[model samples]
Target: MAEIIEDFLVKKDQGYYCAYGDFYIDPLYPVQQAVVSHAHGDHASPGHQAIYCTEATAAFMQIRYAKQALSSYQVKDFEQKFHLNGVDILFYPAGHILGSAQILMIYQGVRYLYTGDYKLQEDNTCEPIKIVEADVLITETTFADPNVKHPDPKEEILKLAVASNIMLGCYSLGKAQRITALLNQYLPEKEILVHHSMLAFHRIYDKFNEVPMKYELYNRKSMKGDEKNKVYLIPPLTFNSYRRAKNVLRVFASGWARLQASNDLSLYLSDHVDWEDILTFVKQVKPRAIWTLHGDGRQLHAHLSDDLIIRDIFTQTYRPDFC
Candidate 1:
């Protein structure tokens, strides 16, 4: 019998190693030629010698990697097709981050789509997710359990802002921007306080003219414990620490929050597509074979069509030990 998976491949007289969505040189396995779907550390490694990504991903990578050698790598834009050896590849917005992409590879006569984490909901800070049909689909199964269903991002944000004295703690980047924009739309007069990390990303968002609210950025030191009727944006890790703040309610925005693990009343926001959304996307793409990555792949695999041949490959930076 053939190996369930092959690590190395010989194509056009060149040897390459495949690990999930990443590819590298043979013996050296230097991770030289990389097609990154997003700037997330799990997907885009700093160790790669050459990188192909969207312009927005390139910018975020510059901040994350912080080295001229890494910055020297090439960056590509969405929908731009390029040929490496004989394989043709293209990038499409994944709707995960400002520069996130879903890589489409055309090798021989087959088309393979590797979805880096994606969301179907519309976010004001970045391009909307584009649905593309493919022969084989490699997608993230982060919230693939049947019981998981997210409230519309816009509605969740508005509800959180209106119900709480302080809306606090979420991912500093993409999710925060989405929340802030929704807050601006529904609670225009409210004050917003963001963590330093969020402020940095917010600055970048503003640079791109993506910020929806005219708000001030604040740090922990600046917070005077007077957070009444204010929305405080913070990193997920900071949620427990700020739980004691007076008149402050802690809320986390992420796809994972839909699970029972997030039973806390403060956490109700999610920017990712839930189980229902995942099924919808899969049904729409209608791929013959589907590979799951990120989140609970096993749960997702159970729900997919038996004919769709499911394979699990862990590609989440947030949970590196998953594989």
Candidate 2:
């Protein structure tokens, strides 16, 4: 049976270090060489000497970090093979966000796939997941418990149909664009208003979409009852900062129950794969061994049979510094 090559990628104080490639995958702090999996702040950091990622990821990182963006970017297309420190590396679409990627490293004939925040659910705002087989699968277990099953996103989006005036709390980057597209598609009657902070991200995503999304910038004038149905999409922080708003239904879209409890309506929407999706992906990829990060993996270990090797990388010792 295949096992984790400890020396290949060791858990360092900063992040996951690959001695073979001389790089860190989604490092928490600045490093000499970072192979960033996506544009998410937690995964992508500033002050890296050099970054290797997809073109879209580079764009998003630049927009997010501004002046702090990396000095040099070795941007590449998906599925294109590039040699880095004697290892063959390829970026596969992770389906988590617009520029999210699953980094694949092939060294000495053994393949290792690092899945950085992936989902099997259909999302029109970004590229869908492209599953590839590997000897070792290092995946994010954000929702890998047997009890958590994410509801259909389309169905969850429809929950706002009844509320004429709605305030949606979403993450500014990926979640904002997704909710905007869903509102435009399923709830066409609603006038989508995007927060100014998220407008740049929406505009960036628009460049990659076949048809541009429809949204107006959020303003106090629009919040007035001039429009019949209005949905204002704001980031979670902004949503919570408000003390109260008149005649508006407050809702936050997330898989976590705590966020849903704070809002007037529950919208169980998430970009991460649920337990069933994880199981389906595991079956499709047919990995020899599995290593999980990002969340608790005790349930996954207990549910899967002994034939499958399951290891949790985010235990006490190997935990990431960012968290």
Clashes of each: 0, 0
Off by over 4 Å in 2: 1-4, 69-71, 314-323
Deviation in angstroms for 229 in model 1?
Answer: 2.3
TM-score of each candidate structure, all chains considered together: 0.81, 0.94
lDDT at residue 217 of model 1 (Cα atoms)? 76
| Cα-based RMSD of candidate 2 | 2.8
User: What local lDDT does model 2 show for residue 267?
Assistant: 97
Q: Candidate 2 — which pairs collide?
A: none
Give a tens-digit lDDT track for model 1, residues 1-323: 12223221212112223434344322122355766777665566666667777777777767766773755567777788887766678898888878888878766566777777888877777888898998777777777788877776666666564545564667776777767777787778677778777776666677765454566777654455544567767786776666566655555665554422542443456656788888889888878777765567787777665657776642323222211
